[model samples]
Each structure stands twice: as C-alpha cells, then as structure tokens.
Target: MSSATRRPNTNCIHSGTRIDPAVGGVNTPIHMSSAYLQPNPQAPETCYPRYMNIPTQQAPADKIAALEHGEAGLVLATGLAAITIPILAMMRPGAHAVFQADLYGGTHHFILAEMERLGLAYTLVPETDPEAIAAAVRPGTTLVHLESPTNPTLKIIDLAATARAVKETNPDAVLCIDNTFATPMNQNPLDLGFDVVMHSGTKYLSGHSDLNCGAVVTSAARMKAIRETAVNIGTSLAPFDSYLLERSMKTLAVRMERHNANALAVAEYLERHPKIGAVHYPGLPSHPGHAAAARQMRGFGGMVSFELGDSPEAARAAVQRLSVIASAISLGGVESTITFPAETSHYKMTREERLAIGVTDTLARLSVGIEDVADLLEDLEGALAAL
Candidate 1:
C-alpha cells in the first residue's frame, strides 16, 4: 500500500521515502546540489533548491504535507518566514488580516509592527469563540491567523468551528493556524477544515533543539502564491537541514506517544500540588477548552502551563531550583524544559498586555518531553517546592 493511504504512523516513515537510485540505500540521500541539469533550456521548469523543487527539500516537505493531509508543503529558514510569506502572499493591496491575540510573541509582534507598514490593515480578536472570529471578518480581510494550544497559555482554539466561521463569513480569506504545539501526531488542522497549517519545525517537528526550520502545508492552489513569495524572499531551507527534519519525523510517532503520556502525568501532578494555582492543559478535564480539544484532537499536546504564584520572583526562583528540566526559551525537544513567559516568550508584551491575554507574571510554560513520568514529575516537584 502507498504510504499516503496508510496510517499516519506509517506515513511518517515512508510517505516521502524515495530510495537512492545510485545505491539501495534505505534513506533518501542528501542531494547537496544547488543546481540540477535541465533536459531542455526552454522547458521553463528546472530543479533548484531555492525553488523548492529538488529532492532533498521536497522529501521532508512531502512528508509533512502528507502528515497534515495537505496537497503541497514548503520548508523555510524559520517559522516566522513560513508564516510571514503565506500571509503576505495572500494579501493584496487594500486587503486586511484578522489575528488571534494569543499567539507566539514573534508573530504577534510582527502583526503589531509590520502589518500597517506593509499596507495591510488588521484586526486583533481577543476572544476564541468562533462567533467573535466571524464577527471580526471584514469584506477585504484576506487572512485569518490563529494558534492552538497557544504559546505559554495552553488555550485551545476550536479549529473546525473557527474555519467554518472564517470561510462562511469570507470565503476568500485563508484560514491559517500555527500547528507547532500540537504537531501532526496530535492534530491535523487540515482535516478539521483549516486551509493552511504552519509549524516551527524547530519545535516538535524537528524533535530537537539543534536546528531552526519552518514549514507550511496547504492545498496546492493556495501554495502556489506562497511558493512564489518564498522563492523571491530566499527563505528555502538548506538540503542538510531538510534531511535532518525528515529523519526527525521518522521518530515523531514514537516520540509523541511518550510526550503525550508524560505530559498528562506531569500536568495531573502539577494540578494537585498546593503551589500550582491554575493548570492549563487540555488533557485535564478542568481546562476550559477540554471539551473542544477532546472532540478535535487525538491527543492532548505535551505542553502545559500553570501559575506559580502572584510574583515573578517566585516563578524565577522555582525555575532556578530545577535540576533535570532546563529553564529555556525553545520547546518540544526530547529533554523537558520550562519557561517563565513573563521573562521569555511574552516578555515583549507589556505587563498590561500580558495580563489582558491571561498571561500572568507567574505563568510557567512547560514543554513536556519523552522522559520517564516519574522523573519528570519529580523534577517539576523539586522546582515547585522552591516556591
């Protein structure tokens, strides 16, 4: 059976598997060429790395594309580039954008700083209800952007409802989501009605903190414009990084199993502790969006957020006490890490702005890794005890 038609776990290993013709190598060999020979000079199409047509780049792109059930995909130098290129391509003069306020700080800051400069008007929707999203859509809005299990907050956006609302309100508007946190193993936004799915491959998709990469998956029709923009902007990922990303995905299915299990166990432990004020993880029934997440997501993601206390000092002290989990900025690696959002991801936002979006000074965002649940729980317990 073809990999695409097979189950997702199988697709991870074989969807883009094209054996080396030079030898019977099991893995796709890295084609370290910037140029490829064209049979006809006037043929108009030629294999090029920047064009995202070469085998090395296409292999990983195809794997993620199939995983998300998208018709096409592209990898970029950074997650910002992957997301920025598509939003810019889809927007023409006089077109606007609607962005959910709870976002990765970089994306949120980009909208606030760059949209108007680029001549695109935007609306920031503060709420998650699909009705609110539909209500915010203007006739000229060309893009609607959101992230599920939102950064540092663990808020779940209703993917299907939000997509339906966006399309029904403005069919021309492209509904794009940052699927970085959930990863394809937990959720496929395309299957839930989203038009485009974006990922910071630096996170779960790469499953390691060693590289920086980004990916976009969407229908073939919409990707044409994004591809053109990306080529012009020179953001295509290198062959070696693409190869590594493809290899990382081979282990995604197995790694995420442990991530999901360990995360749930950790979140439950945190929820019961006297020091944890509020635990935000969809796996817990107490989470506000638990019902929607249960309906839409196959597994509650490995990320968890909680309130440490009223002061930022307490949050800082707790992280300093951690021995096993690193207090780091980036997430989704095999090693468990924690971040104080007030000092890291959401640091750019003013105190009032952070509070407005439910990001308190005490909020700690935990990227649960594939560690033994007992060790992870103990690590977190040691950290929280310092509070």
Candidate 2:
C-alpha cells in the first residue's frame, strides 16, 4: 500500500525501514563504513557515505517526508544548517526574499547578518498576515519564508492564504516554513500549499534531547537540489544520528499527544492565574491566532509564552524558583524547559526590536513536556507564588 493510505502512527514506525535480507532483521542496520568497494566503474557509484544515501540515513529522511506528506526529504547535522541550506540553495545574487519579522532569532540574525554578504535582498514583514506578506513581495522576490505559532509569541499565519498570495505574486518563488514549533503531528504546512517544510528534529522528532538533527521536506525536485546543497556544505546528518532519529520518530505520535494535553492544561492554568499578565497560546480562545490555528492545525502545539504581571526581574525570579522545569535554552524535549527570551533566544535583538515583535522583557517561553498535568501545574503555581 502507498504511504498516503497509512495512518500517521504506522508511517512513523515503518515509513523508512528496509529490513536486512541477510539476517531478516526488521530494523535497518547502520552501515558505518565511510567508503564502500565499488565493483563497476561505469555504473552509478554508491561508494561513499555522503554520496550513497545509505539505508540508515535514508530511513529517517523517508519517515520525515511521509509524516510531512512531502515528496522527499533531507536530514541535516543541525536545525540551523537545515534552514541555511534551503535558503542558500533557492537564492542567488540579486534575488529578493520576504520573511516574517518575528522569526526564530537565529534565522532573523542569519538573514540580517548575511543578506548583504550573500548578495541577496530581503524584506522583513512585521506581521504574519497573508496580505502583509504579499504586499512585501517585490518583482524580484524569489522566496517567501514564514513561521506559524511564531517563536516566543504564538502567532499563527494563514498558510494557505499566504501561499496563494505569494504564488500569485511570483509563481516560481519558493514558500518555506519553519515547522519546529508545530510538529508534523500538529500541523502539515506542505498540505497547506507551502513548497518546503523545515524542522528542528532536536525537538519533538527526537523526543529525547540526546540527538541533534534537522530535516527539510519538499518536492522530489526540490529535495534533489537541497540534497546536493547539503552534501556540498557537509551538513548531512551522520549515519548514527540518523539511526537514532528514526528510532525516536517511532513514538512521535504518542509523545505529541501528551505534549498537546500537557501544554493546553498549562496554558489554561496560566490564563486563569492572577500573576500572569498575559498568556500566548493558540489553544487559548483569547489568543489572536486561535481561529486561524484551529483551521490549519490538528493540535495547538506544546509551546506556551506568557508574561509576568510585575516585571522582567519577577519573570527571572519565577524561572529560578521552578523545580520541575529546567532553566535552559532550546525546547521540545520530553522534559519541560523555560527561558526568558529577552535574556536568551532574542537577547541579540535590541530592546526596541524585541518590543516591536511583542517579545517584551516580561515574556517567558515554555516548551511544555509530557510530564503529569498535576505536577506541572503545581510547579508553575509554586513559582508564581514566589513572584
């Protein structure tokens, strides 16, 4: 049967596996040899790890493609590399691109810092609205990049509408989405007309924080270009890391279910709490993007951002008092993590720039884990009480 007919959970487990005929093993074996002996010079060569696309690495790439409903995919060494590879591949000298201003800080920094050096021009749209994005597209625009349930501020964009608008403006322009905040279990941007979907597999895809990997899913033709670009940049995921990513994806569906439940519970609790000045979660009806998110997503996702009623100092104190959640950077693991965007992720941005994007000093970002709802709530409440 075709992968399209299989359920997500089934696809997660079997999408990429190629049983070894020699041992009849169900799992794909890791081919650790960097070099393979070639018997024929005329035939296409599969004589090197980077050039061959070995089974272990290909397995997870196939699984990610299946999950995102894309034609093909490439796994990379890191999420940042995943983002950079695609953008670099699609852009060239004098090419123009449009991007959301509230993008993940790293991406924002990359574009701002490298555009001139790369000989590309770009426009940063201040809002996630499709019309605003379309308006920013110039005649030279070659790409349109978007993020939904935006970082540190859960702003959801209308993917279909935006894709339509971008394509209308420049039919050949590529539309890319950073799908890290909303895992494939929660949202599938490719189905909504996006040309490319990127993920920080270090997050929910791995479930455990032990692996560092990134993924890009797109049409077969686009995948070919991306794979070539990745190989040249030396960003291809290692065979061992790919094996781990494949194993972790087997439980993606179950883990995301728990993440959804735990995050919704946490968001609701914070919304009702007296000390929270504001709560930004698509699951919350009061959130500006709730309706759009409901229309496009299966779940509202695990991330939640909220502000302390008092000040940035109070937010820092609350995070310091937390016992269950770790005070650290990076997110989307089995363990909950909290970080102040002003101090970590978006610290590089000026105060004015951060405020322009609604990332206030008091805002705290949360990657709610699969922990028990009661325990998570108690931990958060205790922290708030201390504030």
For model 2, the superposed segments whose C-alpha errors exceed 4 Å read none
Clashing pairs for predicted structure model 1, backbone only: none
Clashes, model 1: 0
Q: What are the TM-scores, per candidate, against the unseen true structure?
A: 0.97, 0.97
Q: How many backbone clashes does candidate 2 have?
A: 0
Taking the tens digit of each residue's C-alpha lDDT, what string does model 1 give over 1-387?
865678988999998867887799989888899878889999998988889888888889999999999999898998899889998888877888899988988898888777867878889999988999889998888889999989978888888988888889999888899999999999999998889999999999899888899999998988998999999989999999999999999999999989999999988998999877999999999999999999988899889998886688877887888888988889999999988887788888888889989888788899998877898888777777767
Instruction: Rate residue 252 of model 2 by lDDT.
Output: 95
- For each of the candidates, the C-alpha root-mean-square deviation to the true structure, in angstroms, is 1.3, 1.2
Rate residue 21 of model 2 by lDDT.
96
Write the residue-wise lDDT of candidate 2 on 1-387 in tens digits.
778999999999999887899899888898898877767867785655675288888899999999999999888888888898899998988788999999899898899888767768899999888989999987888889888989989899999899998888888889999999999999999999999999889988997889889999999988888888888878878888988999999999999999999999999999999878889999999998899999999999899999875877777888888899999888999999998898888988889999999999888899999989899999998889977
Which residue pairs come into collision in candidate 2?
none
